[model samples]
Target: MIIGYARVSTLEQNEALQTDALDKAGCERLFTDHASGAKAHRPELDRLLDVIRDGDTLVVWKLDRLGRSVQNLVDLMNLLQSRGVGFKSLTENMDTTTPGGVLVFNVFAAMAQFERDLIRERTNAGLQAARARGHKGGRPSKLGDRERARIRELYQSRALTVQEIADQYHVSRKTIYSSIKNTR
Candidate 1:
């Protein structure tokens, strides 16, 4: 069975074009969603995944319609392949059921993974260089010595509530509590 999936980012956008293409491509069933690709949950897509069986092919008008990013596309392909299902992208002319298509998809997935690994390596190297320069990587402290002293004095005097001190210092109640604990 060939199942089609179509998506539009906003309500104003129409899925007619994708649906027409899918129908022409011999899609027996269709699922549609009016949601952003960046959204983590897509109801119709999830339903299609749940209902598709082994040996079925999942078709999309375009590769981007199925996933938000290259990594996401690769992940979805991996899942479908693991389940013995195939994938086809109309615009990309990709069909995972064929040897050439499989090769192409594999190459794309490898490139995405390589890019992610390179990014991670570069970020780690940058962080290590910063640490070597005695620069820590968290947010700078919001309260200084004077503020800390005032917080301690207020708490010790029991004249102001934690919330009151937080408002006076433009900090959060949690910050006031943490400062007090550090002083102790």
Candidate 2:
């Protein structure tokens, strides 16, 4: 069975072109999604995956219509291959059933991995630079030194529960615990 999947970003966008292409490509079953490609969940796509089985080919009008990101596309491709299902993209002329197609898909997957590594490297470098300037990341601490000291004093006295100290400072018990951890 050849199943087709089509998507449009919003209700206002039309999937007619995609559907038409899939129809022309001899898709026996079709699923349509009226959600953004970036969205993690698509009910129609999920349903299509649930019903598809080995020897079935999954077709999409374009690569972008089938995935939220390059990594997502690569992951999906690997999943389909593991399930013994083939993948075909109309625009990219990708067909996992062929040797050339498999090579192309692997190249795309490698590129996605390369892109992720570059992003991770750049982010680490930027953080290192910021640290050199004494700039810290993450949410600003809610309580100051006085508040932390008071919390420690109250905690040592055992007169107040951690929750009580947290309520007084408008912070979480975890914050109180962290303060305690840092103090000691």
Whole-model Cα lDDT per candidate?
A: 0.95, 0.94
Clash pairs, model 1 backbone: none
Q: Provide the lDDT at 109 for model 1.
A: 94
TM-score of 2: 0.94
Top candidate on lDDT is 1
How close is every model to the real structure, measured as TM-score? 0.78, 0.94
lDDT per residue as tens, model 1, 30-112: 99999999998899999998999999999999999999999999999999999999999999999999999999999999999
Clashes of each: 0, 0
Which of the numbered candidates is closest to the native, going by highest TM-score?
A: 2
Error of 1 at 52 (Å): 3.2
